[model samples]
Target: MTILITGSTGLVGSRLLQRLLEAGYDCRAMVRGGRPKPAGAHAVEGDLFDTESLARAVEGVTAIIHLAAVFRTGDEALIWKSNFDGARNLMAAASAHAPHARFILASTSNVYDKSQARPGCESDAVAPTQAYPASKVAAERALCESGLTWTVVRFPFVYGDGDGHLEELPAHLLSANWHPAMRMSTIHHRDIATAMVLALDGKFDGHVVNIADDVPASMLDLIALSRGEMTASARPLAEPWAMQVDTALARSLGFRPTIRTVFHAAEQQLL
Candidate 1:
């Protein structure tokens, strides 16, 4: 089936595009700012602000993996336009052109506030404190309210080779050793891509699932794993960012990820 992927050049989107192409699926990539599209995929150049451009991108596509969104630290307006409005625009286009197609929207676990206890589930209340998470919540709401066939995958921090966050963690740790003891949930980028493909074929429809690896590590454990030193004394944040996702939903649907494999992938990239 033809699958249209937004943010085809990003860390997660690029990897997902490669995997989808390798699997012999017809892939269409929607990109912004005239960036060159990856080979072996149909490239559709357009901006999210332009509804007509977005409609053209979704036309004739069987499925859509919505991954395009802003993740900047500042600039609320840009974040809102890119994350919330952009997502709404795409959803509207998909509803109009490909309403029956499987639409997978990549959301984040950060939609849960810091006050949330560990092992957050899909049914947990959404309390987005940051602009990024707020935008994701807004996007999720829009998709759910649109009455279209959609699945929202709330992903934890994804890391793997060529990941910008993995590369910067060492420097961020070394500079101030401000290693808060926050519980970090991570999934390999490959796993995220794999899950997306599985969800497309799986029985779960119009449901939200939390996609993450089996193991959840604290910041201290991550530092030890990354730097080979357990002496970094950055206590865990009082409001730890721990998420014990009920993978039961995904598991019941026949999806599981090897946490060890993901960890090894991150280690290879970090060290």
Candidate 2:
């Protein structure tokens, strides 16, 4: 089975591509802007904005792992175009050129409602005001409506394998003024591959699955773990469950994370 991966140079996508290639999977990378192709994988030169290129990328692959997205940017227009419009374009190309290919979308847990009273579940109605998550939600709905076999893996704070995502968390949360006590679910890079392999096997077919590790950590502890300092506070949190997620569905579908927690990553020096 040939798997086509978009965003092969991004944080999650690059790492995932490496893992899949190491395991000897037939892989193709959708490259754009004349970027160099990855080693040991076929590079299908394409752009998400260009449908013709997308068609070429989706031509005969058995599956499409779409990790391309715009996040952590101030540009709203770019975010919407890349996240929503681009996704629809790719879906259209897949439907027209590769109707039987499994389409796996990498969504974020940030799409969950900010005021969620419990761990964000697959059934929760999300209304993200931020452009990034809002655009992801739109893309997700469009793909579900499209006549294609699809699965959405909503990821939490993804870190591990020296990705530096966790290292930058303190500055981000500080800028957003996150509560010190606010807790969030997290997933290791290895576990993301685990979820994707499960999706490729039809374990999460036609569903939105939450992929997170066993425990949730607080912003205060996370800041310390990242070695960034912030003033401590004990104020009550208005959205205590904002970033926490329910992984029961993923577990039921047979996803057991090899790294159980961020603390485990710390212990293994995987941060």
Candidate 3:
């Protein structure tokens, strides 16, 4: 089966592409003008804003892994356009050209409310304060209502594989005043590809699922694993469970994480 992957050069997409290719799948990556495609991926010159390019990108593919999004941006408008508008354009193209293709969206756990009554789950109400998560929520809604076979993979904190995501986490948490005791869910890069392969096989069709591992790690432990340090504090955490998610749904849907925790990743030298 031919799978069309968006955001093929970005961190998650790039790693995922290599995994898919190694698994011996026919992968077509959407690339912009003059950008070098990763080896083993067939390249298609596709732009999120360009309807013609999007149309060309989706044609005859068996499935689409929509990983393209903007999260680390100061520009709110660009975030909305790229994350929401770009997804809508791709959905439109898929609807017209590859109506039978499965559409898998890569979303974030940040869509859950900070004041949630319990651990975040797929069925909970969401009102994200940040534009990034808000736009991802909007994109997810579009895919659900687009009358296409769809799945949404809401990633928690994706790190590992020497991608530098973990290395940069300490500063972001420190600046945001995150409590050292506040535990957060995470998934290694290898497990993400495992979940995506299941999604491609219709294991999670027509559902929004959280893709996480067997364990959640505290900020202190995570920072230590990254070999970075966080300021120690016994201060109260206003939202201890804010970033945590419920992964029972994923396990029920047949996803068993290969890297069960940050410790597991460290032991395997995957971090």
lDDT of 1 by residue, 48-100 (tens): 88888888989998888999888865898889888999898888888888888
Residue-wise lDDT of candidate 3 within 49-82, one digit each (tens)?
Answer: 8999999999999999999888787999999999
lDDT of each: 0.78, 0.92, 0.93
Report the alpha-carbon TM-score of model 1 versus the true structure: 0.89
Best by TM-score: 3
Model 3 stretches with alpha carbons more than 4 Å out: none
Instruction: Pick the winner on lDDT between candidates 1 and 2.
Output: 2
Q: Report backbone clashes per prediction.
A: 3, 0, 0
Error of model 1, residue 253, in angstroms: 2.0
Residue lDDT tens for model 2, 51-108: 8889889998999999999987999999999999999999999999999999999999
> The CA-based lDDT of model 1 is what?
0.78
Alpha carbon lDDT at 107, candidate 2: 98
Model 2 spans > 4 angstroms off: none
Q: Residue 38 error for model 3, in Å?
A: 1.3
Where's the lowest-lDDT run of ten residues in candidate 2?
166-175
Ten-residue stretch with the least lDDT total in model 3: 169-178
